[model samples]
Target: MKNSDSGARAGALEVREEQDPLLHRLMPSPDPAARFFWMSGADGRLRIEQCDACEYLVHPPSGHCPRCGGDRCTPRPVSGRGTIHSYTVNYQQWFVGQPPYIIVIIDLDEQAGLRLTSNLLDCAPDDVFVGMRVSVRFLARHGVWYPVFVPSQAMESDSA
Candidate 1:
């Protein structure tokens, strides 16, 4: 199947092997605090750290709450909606396929300072801009799933 917006093929064959050798080497084993964040994607949910005491949301999964130094943080589902806080287009041949791709820092809607760094798929690298709305889509590789963002439906319609 072809993606209507990006013209890229989609569905079951979309997930490819890690084409960047350095990225493959740098993929870390999920620590206890981050295990849920990693595994929840396989279950089709975006989970982040939520502090039980202060109600602060944390990304990158921390053992203690950065706000109140509380140890009562747990994984909670987030809306998976965000805005592109920042991004860059890479022109180097780091991965397979083409030379240019977009990497974005998403500021998740759940809380301030809750952000994730992920690739933006289903759009041209040059099309990405700060403050662009996006939503998460999961891709599996090597038995692990990751949450990547794509242009939100609103953004798609605006472009159309």
Candidate 2:
């Protein structure tokens, strides 16, 4: 089959090598930030960028902090707790096995203006809405455990 993403960034992603149940990876990104992000996913954890200088948590990496012009940074594990700020169901998809999926923008807990985009699975796409509670789940794909979100199971059971 033809490749879906042929961009440079996609080329750099870890492609899965199937040997058994565990992922066999090659040349994982050595940058601490990237390694930290991927490592967390492997462990089913979620992380956001932490500004080392000012203690501000940033969602997207920047050359300098907007809050405090400090350059130092680290990847810190987040609570995996968030609210769905916005979302969309992609009825027509260009990627395989990903059609009819929901893409969500999540606002993380505890860090002001901290948010990220990810897929929402194991839920009815039409049911997702703004301000919905969500939590992270890692889906192992192409030798990586990508961080995806779904409605919190705990919240659902509690509401029952």
lDDT, candidate 1, 1-160, per-residue tens = 2334332211112323352222542454958778787666665567888889998988778768888999989888777778999999878875565547788999998787788998887678777899999877666665566677778863344334
Q: Poorest 10 consecutive residues of model 2 by lDDT? A: 6-15
**The CA-based lDDT of model 2 is what?**
0.62
State each model's CA lDDT, in order. 0.70, 0.62
Question: What does candidate 2's lDDT look like per residue over 12-113, in tens digits?
Answer: 122232311222223345564465665566654566678888889876655457789788887776677789988988776454443476888989876756
As a TM-score, model 2 comes out at: 0.70
- RMSD of each candidate? 5.9, 10.5
